[model samples]
Target chain A: MPTQRDGTPVSVLARQLRILDTFDAGTVFLSLSEIAERSGLPMTTTHRLVAELVEERMLERLPDRSYQLGLRLWELAARTPRAMGLREIAAPMVQFVQGQVRQHTQLGVEGGYDVVYLDRASAPNAVVNATIVGGRISLGASAIGHVLLSDKPRAFLAKIVEAGIRRYTDKTPQTLDELVDVVDRVRELGYSVADGFIHPAARGMAAPIYGPDGRVLAGLGMVVPSGEPVNMRIVELLRSAARRVSQQMRAAYIDPDHPHALPGAKFRVLINSSKSSMEYFEGNEGG
Target chain B: MPTQRDGTPVSVLARQLRILDTFDAGTVFLSLSEIAERSGLPMTTTHRLVAELVEERMLERLPDRSYQLGLRLWELAARTPRAMGLREIAAPMVQFVQGQVRQHTQLGVEGGYDVVYLDRASAPNAVVNATIVGGRISLGASAIGHVLLSDKPRAFLAKIVEAGIRRYTDKTPQTLDELVDVVDRVRELGYSVADGFIHPAARGMAAPIYGPDGRVLAGLGMVVPSGEPVNMRIVELLRSAARRVSQQMRAAYIDPDHPHALPGAKFRVLINSSKSSMEYFEGNEGG
Candidate 1:
C-alpha cells in the first residue's frame, strides 16, 4: 500500500486509483476478487470502492458481473490536452506519413519510463507493428523512445541507465554508453533510425515533434519492413511531417490561454542557430 | 453532493469523480478555486483531493498551476471495451465508408440520453460536422441517435421524452410523436436519414451496428451537404458496412473469456426472420 510522507496510509482516492491501475491492455475485465487481489486491498474495502466506482460510472459492471473500465473515463480524457489535443493536431500529419509510406505510422509521448502511443495509422497489410493506440514501449528500446528522451537532462539519462534497459533484439542498445550515443545522435540529426531494434522483421525511424515551448513534446515515426536498405526518403518525410506538426503546436501555444497548451516545467523554447538541429532541418527542408 | 440510498453522503471516490466531471471540452483547464467552485466542495476538501489527484496523475498540474485531465485517465480508458474495443473493431468499416463517401463517417454508442461518438473518419474537405470522438449528441436530434435508441425499452424512451429534446433546427423532432416516428422509421428501414436536423447545411444518415449479443450496439453514419437529394447508394453502403461490423462483433463475443465483450443488462441475442431488420439488411446485401 502507498503511504504519505508522514507514514500515514493513503486516502480512499489513492486506493480507488490503484484499482483503476490494475486494468491494462491484457487485463481488461476483472471480477471483484480479481480487483481485490491485484489492488492489494482488503475484500471489503475493495467491494466498497468498487461499488462507489460503478455508481460513478468509472467502472462498468458487465453481464457476468465482471468489471471493466467505463466510458466516463474516456469522456473525461477527451478533455486532456496532453493526449487528445496532441493527437487531434498531429493526426493529419501522421495520416499523411502513413498514406505516403503505406506502413504503420504513429505519434507517441513520453510517459514515465515508457513511450505511450497517442495515435497510429496502419495500412491493411502493413509490416508487423506491435504498438497500438494508448499502448507503451520501453523508452530505451525504440526509435521513438530515443527521440522523446533526446532532450532530457544528463541526470535523468543516468537514472534511466541505472534502471537498465531490456534486451528486445541484438540491435537494441544494452549499455549506458550505447544508449547515450543513440540519444546524442538523435539530438544531432533531428531524427532516429533503429534497425531491427524492437524486432528483426521491422525497422523504425522517428523525429521529434516540438511544442510551442520548443521542447520535444512527442515523437512521430513509421515502422517499415526490414531486409531492405534504409530509406532516407522516408526519414525526410518524417522530419518534414514532424516540422509541420511542431509549427502547429507553436501556433496553438502562442495563445497561452488556449486549452490545448500542455503544461510541463521542462518545456523550453528552441533557439534557432547553425548548431541547432531543428534549425538545421528547416534549412535542409527549405521551410 | 450526491448521497446514497440511506441518505449517507457519497464516498471520496464520488467526490473525486465530481472533481473530474468539472472538466469538459470547453473547460479543459481548471484552477484549484475553479474546481472547488464547480464541484461544489469545500475549498479545503477540494485542495486535499486535488493534491491527491495530481500525485496520482489523474490530473496533471500545468506550468501555471492549473489542472487538466491527465494521460493516466486516457491510458485507463484505452482498456474500456465500450469505447476503445468497439472502436478498434469498427474502425476499418468506418474508414471504408468515409473513403467511399468522401465525407464525415462515424460510429457512436448510446451513453445515457446521448449518442457518444467513438470513432470518426473525415475527408479534408468534408462537410461541416459538429461531432468529435467522445462528443455527444442528443437521442432526438441526430440520425445516429435515432438508430442507437431504436432498441431501447418504451419506459426509457418515455423518460427521454419527459426530459424534452433540444431543437437545433426546424427539421429536428419537436414532440414525442415525431421522435417515436423517427425511431420506428429507423427500425423499419434498417437505417436512418436525418435531413437538416442538427443544422441547415448538413444532413446525417445512419445504420445500427450490432454487438455479439445481436442487440443494437452502436450506429455508423455519414454527414454530407444537406441540399443534395438523398443518395440511395450511400444508404446501401452504410447498411453493408454496418453488417460487416456486426459480423465481427459476433465473432468477438463467441468466446466468453474475450476481454472486449461489453457488459450491459439490456443486451440480447438478435433473432433472425423475414421481418427482422438485421435479416432484411443481410438479404438485401445478399449476405
Candidate 2:
C-alpha cells in the first residue's frame, strides 16, 4: 500500500486518520510530541497532519497549545441519525432507570466482539463498571454483551468464541463453551445476567431492544452491587424500556407515512425541532 | 491545494470528509449515486471511495446496499472529551429543567456567529424550535444566543453584528445597535429573555455557564410559549444549574489532587462508574 511521506503502511488519508485515532476516552488533549509518539509518525509528519487537522477544525488548539477534538467533530457526531437518535429516544428512559436503580443505566449496541455504549445515566458514587457513553467493553464481560451476543448468528458467535475470551474477573465467562451457553440462555430468556463478570463487585442484567423489523438493535443494561440479590423489578424495567426504544428505532427507519410501522410505536421522542442553521460549518470539511 | 484525481480543489482526505459529511441528521442513508451527487464528486471517484470507506467501516452498507454512518464513527465520537463531558455533566439538570418547565431545555456553546446546541431534553411535543443538538442558529435570534453573545469580546460581537443579523421573525433583533443593547442587558442581569424571536409563538431565557476562570463557556436556555410571562423561578433554576456545570467544567481542567476546586465545587456529576474496557477497539486502526 502507498503510504504518507512518513512511510506509514497506508495512504495519506489513512495516516491522517491514524493521527485522529491516537485520541480515545482516556487521552483527549495531546501535544505534538505526544501525538507523534502515539501515532508512531515522525515529528515533521505529525506536525503537518496536526496543522491540517487544526485548520479544518477537526482538531482544535487548547489555551495551553495542546490539541483536543474540535467542536466540529462533535457536531458531526451529533448529526448522526441512528446513534444520536437512539440516545435521544432512550435518554428519558435511561434517566428514569438510573433514578430507580441508582447504579448505572446504559444503552449499547454490538460492534464486533465488543458492545459500544451509546448513552448512559451514571448514578452518583456507584460501584466500578466497565461501561459509559461512548465507551465500549468486551462482550465476554457484561450483561449487555450477552444480550447482544444472543442475537448474533451461530457462525459469527462461533468465530468470536474461537478467537478467545478474556476474563475480566474470576467469574467472567472464560471459555468458548461458557460463552456459547451464556448466549443460549440470553436467547431463551430475552435477557442476560452476568454477576461479577466485569468488576468483582458489579452485577448486571441486560434486555435486548428490537427494531421495527424485529431485529435486535441494541441492549439496555443496569449494573448494581453484586452483593445485592438479583432484582426482578429491575429486569422488568429493562424489558419495558428496551421495548419502547426498539419501537422508536423501527419508526426512524420507516417513513412517517408508512403504515408498516408497528402500531403501538409512536415516534413521540423524535420530533426534530430544528431546520439546522449550520451555514457557519458548511466549509472546512476534513477527514 | 493538491486536488483529488478528479481535479477538485482539495486533498483526498478532504474528499473523504465530504463523503462523511453528506450523512447528517436529515440524510442518514444514501445510495452511491446520491452520495456522489451530494458530495459533488464524480461517479467513478465516489464509487471507489465509497468502497474504501465501507471497507474502513466509516460508512456502513445497509441491507439494500445504501450507506449510513457506521458504529465506528459513533465510537470515535464517544471518545471526544469536551462535547461528551459537557453533555454528561449537564444531562441531569437538563432533564430537571424540562420536567419543571415542560419545554425545550438545552445547553449551547457559541460557535462562530451561532450557538451550537450540545445536549437537550425536549419536553414532549413542545413548541417549534430553531435548533437541535449538532444544530446551530444565529446569535440575534434567541436568548441562548444573547447569553453567549454577552460574554464575547466587543470586537467579536461587532463583527457578527456588522456581518448583518438576519431576522427570523419580526421580533428578532435586526440591527447592530439592538444587538448591542441586548448583550448589555444580558450582561447586566446575568440572563437574557427573547420574546417571539425565532418562532412567532416561542419565547426563551438563557443564563451563561462560566468556567473555573470565570470565562463564559456555554449557555443554558429554556423556551416556552411566547404569551407566558417571564418566569423568575426558571431563571433561578438556570443559574444554579449553570453554576454546578461551571464548577464541574473547571474540575475537568484541573488536576485530580489540586486543592483549589473553588471552595465548594466537587466533580459530583462526573463520578462515571466506568472502568472503560475499550481495549477491543484499541488498534485495528483504519482510515
- Per-prediction DockQ comes to 0.24, 0.35
B161-251: candidate 2 lDDT, tens digit per residue? 7777777778878877778888899989999989888767778889888866677878989877788778889889988888888876775
- Model 1 Cα displacement at A189 (Å)? 2.5
Model 1: per-residue lDDT, tens digit, B97-202? 8768888888899888988987776665666666756778788898999998899876777777788777878888877788888889888988998988986878
Kindly list the interface RMSD, in angstroms, of each predicted candidate in the order they appear: 11.9, 7.6
Instruction: Report, for candidate 2, the interface RMSD.
Output: 7.6
* Model 2 interface CAPRI class: acceptable
Whole-model lDDT for model 2 versus the true structure?
0.74
Evaluate candidate 1 and give its CAPRI docking class based on DockQ: acceptable
Which candidate's lDDT is highest?
Answer: 1
Q: Model 2: per-residue lDDT, tens digit, A14-74?
A: 7777888887665667788989998999899899989888876778887778787778777
DockQ versus reference, model 1: 0.24
Query: What lDDT would each prediction earn against the true structure?
Result: 0.76, 0.74
Candidate 1 chain A lowest-lDDT run of ten: A266-275
Best by TM-score: 2
Predicted structure 1: clash tally = 0
